[model samples]
Target: MKILVVFVVMVLFCDCVMTKECTNTPTQLSSHTYRYALLNSKNKTLKQEVLTLSSHDHDHLTPTDDSAWASLLPRKVLKQEDEFSWMMMYRQMKNNNGGSGKVRDSGSFLNEVFLGDVRLDSDSIHGQAQQTNLEYLMLLDGDNLVWSFRKTAGLPTPGVAYGGWESPNQELRGHFVGHYLSATAMMWASTGNDTLKKKMTAVVSALGECQEKMGTGYLSAFPSEFFDRFEAVQPVWAPYYTIHKIMAGLVDQYVFAGNDQALKMVTQMADYFYKRVQNVITKYTIERHWRSLNEETGGMNDVMYRLYTITGNANHLLLAHLFDKPCFLGLLAIKADELSGFHANTHIPIVVGAQRRYEVTGDPLYKEIGTFFMETVNSSHS
Candidate 1:
């Protein structure tokens, strides 16, 4: 999860600014009230009552409320205006003459902004950090990383599996491989290092083989029954969260390193979940059933939203919406300041996904929810 957070922080770095009115607002809940509300929020009966989405209307994705929030925070920060890539391409906006200039495709904002274009100064702290990160990325043993994956596929596991989280007994055994793929992909893109590219390519190839061996769209170091545990609402350590990391890593590989096989693997993974989610929603309300498990889904919504942008598949778009947690987001949809006692790390990624949703769908509700959450977090929680 730390590595996943590192990847998220690297990609979604933004400046948070709050207005005086927002900051001065008395929105903070008392400790007692927070605890009471938190417990009540977890009430299964009450959740089913309010959180269930009975309507299968496609309009659910498009919120009816177009009312603007009172907050004045901006929605996005252009890359050209930022320090990291000041010279990078940006979407053309209106000029001083009130005329819109030639605009770039919103979906391809970073298409031409290759990381290799920027050279880090070796003496700087960022450069040193990059050097350390690059060395660590290269030092990871590919066999050790994929050992559990091979074992799960009935392939001969030649190398000793790493202890701790990567242990074969661990539910999150294959998650690090995803993180490694993302890091190496980004590193190769940034440095134009042939060695890193080759290493990442080999890993992607091995993962592709594993995916084929499993004979399902699923590809993980653990058995598929983990998801069965997830669907059963039994004790399980965040199967979807691990899958999100894997999907996000494959996405990074395809986007950064231009690996077509990575794209195919991730699309298959999405299709697998799309069908799985379809099966689950048929029995019960998506909101109540999925949220009732109280599992950490990581950025499943965000990754799916990303996949939709790439493939433009309607199923991919709908699947992204399926991962949205209405129990929490429904509160934000109504401008409720009820984030107290909610798991911070777990839900923050939901907001990140909301931002991506707004980008892909042009849904005003998503923008409002994302903007309000950011404003609320900056004003009070931070």
Candidate 2:
């Protein structure tokens, strides 16, 4: 029975490649004509045919006169070899208004299944467990959850902080507050508990106050210097990872609890990171910037993509694309199973981000990355 359950989970995770169709399709009009040199003209013709058929939109097509084409096509191509042509296509899509390039039907997200629509039997074990969880969520003191945040933002700290992970000196002190917000928001939706929603809404309101005090669109238990260390490649705990949790929690509050303030706060947080990442990329090459992803970043890409779905902000979408770790994803894109030495759990969230990216943009490479990673991890690493 356990094996069967695992198999079912694997199948569902690995085969989730399709998405919803977009309503607004971009009008792709190409003006340049291709004038290929006679030498190896046949290969160029084949390449042109391949590009033309890559997508319905010609906007993703590389300019025929561009010198990059010379490097893309070798004289003799292997029949079944994948040159990762989709990478270029995705780049073009990204450049044009942050990958909102009329998503192919197969890559857009299906209609969302709201938690409010679900109901479990009251007497069932699952239902009872949910009730117990909701109760616990309410019992948690909102002041305690925001203590570190208040202190970080120089606001008056009203409640004693929790020990262990929530300790003042803990690098991951405030990560749990984000988790708490996410749980409360979800519980409110699942049970339609107005009390629970009101409590979590107050928490969101408190966090918003903390964010305003900080005045940089940044809100974290730790100092912003953590990110400075993160970008400098110095030793620091997972700052971006912690930030991802907070951002995700705010998103859940907005999505499930309908807290507009939560959305406003999270969008500000995304904007903060957008400028930060762009600065790093400007100071150094993008490849150099990717090296900073060696630390655990949790699901930064996942939350950013989720945020993009709601706000449709180009910077949010750009930030989502930036969080993708190409070194790991590039290998998975090619079906390579080199998950031996890396931390197993750290990469799972990254794969979730890839899944969300595929859902948003319908980029086949992200779909391939997600599917291949799931299959490899389940079969070999399981």
Candidate 3:
């Protein structure tokens, strides 16, 4: 009887993971994932009925009812600015006079200009949409990215070896590969284009194979040694960042494609990382890892949050918070913005995690820091 019961449960589990096809086109998508992310102020209000799912899962909260408290933003800081490539690309707004000018305050006003007052579905984007901009983005992002790494772009170093493409900017290759994977994942989720879906599936497959070949359970378009250096407490570049992109892409695939292999691929990567980098250290472990850690590896825990949501694996969620770099965040704890000339994308998203945490934990300070950082970076960086 027990054996029969186990078999019945197995059959049901298999049924849940079945490979479902996504047929939603761009036109059809206006109602689904597009609408999910493109929610207007009204829809956002409806989403507020919520409470915490966990530290990692989304909080169903929204700013409503006069924001639960009155607040004032520092007026002077609103005009301070910082520069980043992508945010600058979007700040082409012109006032009545056509005299050329840049609206200086990037970090302060960015939130209002982009996430708020300016809508993602604005006619401005549709009217000026050119293939070149999107194509450039497509080329500029992802692991083993062909366009930027093509001999025309540069020469092959690591992951760009696929299809004989080369990239002079070796540092750009890893993160771009990861970003392209994410973009492809987003493109797949948004459009359900069968051709692109197939292409992305193949890309994940090749990446998974490369990961397996290294025997370390981690995978990248670059040398496996990056992970080794990271785990061994040696100096390294953005391993956690690249891993986050790849895992986020996989989770996105599971969300959109319901792909089994993609799910497995991400699980393996997480397992490797969780063991090597996350709390596997001894209490009296070396000083190098203890001190330099907050500098390089922070987002491993954030990705675990998403993976936990996807696989219902509690461990993934637990591990995501393990690398909480409190010092940089201590600045957030105090609402500081001496945050110039450092890693922009890394810290920005980490602040976002704090925002999510506030909603789940009902911690007001998290709200204060997240909102402040978001406002600061939006105005200054964007």
Candidate 4:
């Protein structure tokens, strides 16, 4: 009886192994076999389900008719082949247990599932990053950040180093604080580190306090006199350029980190900016004094467009329109090469603004202008 039972167990094990082997048996594909398979598969529902699941966009799937199946099947098979290749590569990566393998075909799914876990193990680059972020955090002083705003508003100055660019006699002063706030906010979001969050909160709160003290919906490291200098075409550094950076930083903080204070500060700043620019500068003035538009304004128009999207305020949209440099955009819209002597970086932002304007207004003219500018730049430069 013991021998029979042992023999029976061995037979059962062999049968199970054979069944597994049979299920996984690989078939050799010839032209005939491939064609036969495609012809034999008549289940439209099953094919539709497979296609629906594989597509990233289900609602707006390409080729929405039954005719798509004929052409789509070959593409679907190719996609499966690509996926299999990636899986084989991923398996090799797992087996090697090293971060040196290359995945040639990466998509949203592959990035999230496989490559997301892949990272350098104790490399010098990562070590330096820790030191760099630490040093950056140490350099940021919240009190000094609001020094200029405080001074202008009759509040006490904390008397720190005034930051790098925020120092006196520097036109670009206070620009660094905006960039720093933006960087810290991003760092906190990426790492979920409480220290970065604390720094961001401190900087934003200080900015808000300065805005309140000024009592004019104005918040800047410099006084509003800079705009007067800008309007007079005198030797004042790019005030709008610096302000755009700060506004963009604040907007980023709000969008990425859900910082409400940052949003409120930028909104108030936008209001002050609109009233000042609208009162002083006109459409005719912009067209006539085209050289004034050549200054490094950063993407002020882009930021205003974004603000309009967030608030649904017509004022923000109007401000965005006002920032359009007609001289630059006008020439580019006609496919003319007016960018010969222009600063590439300065004008690139304006093109970016044009693109944003196109998105917001759905104006084909803005789209044409942006496309022509981009194509011209790429063709000439590259």
Task: Specify the poorest-scoring 10-residue window by lDDT in model 3.
Answer: 20-29
Give the per-residue lDDT of model 3 (tens digit) for 7-47. 34533544422111111011111122222232222433322
Runs in model 2 with CA error above 4 Å?
1-110
TM-score, structure 3 vs. true:
0.54
Which segments of model 1 are wrong by more than 4 Å? 1-112, 284-288
Residue 71 lDDT in candidate 3: 14
| Residue 93 in model 4: lDDT | 25
Q: Candidate 1 local accuracy as lDDT?
A: 0.67
Error of 4 at 109 (Å): 19
Tens-place lDDT per residue, model 2, 76-193, is 5413344445445545534653366333454235577899999999899999998888878878888888899999999999988887667787677788988998998888888898
The C-alpha TM-scores of every prediction are 0.71, 0.75, 0.54, 0.64
Q: Per-residue lDDT of 1-382 in model 4, one digit per residue for the tens?
A: 6544543453354332211001122111111222223223465554344223322111111222233212323453346545455344334422431212211121322223322233333356874685578567756677867677677677788856474356655566777777777677666655566777777787788778888988998877778898876665443556787898889889878876888988998999999988877766564343323334434577888999888778777788777766766555655554556565455555678889988776666555667878888788788865
Q: How accurate is candidate 2 locally (lDDT)?
A: 0.71
TM-score-best of 2 and 3: 2
User: By TM-score, highest first, what's the ranking?
Assistant: 2, 1, 4, 3
Tell me how far the alpha carbon of residue 200 in candidate 3 is from the true structure, in angstroms, after superposition.
0.9
Better of 1 and 2 by TM-score: 2
Question: What lDDT does model 3 reach?
Answer: 0.47
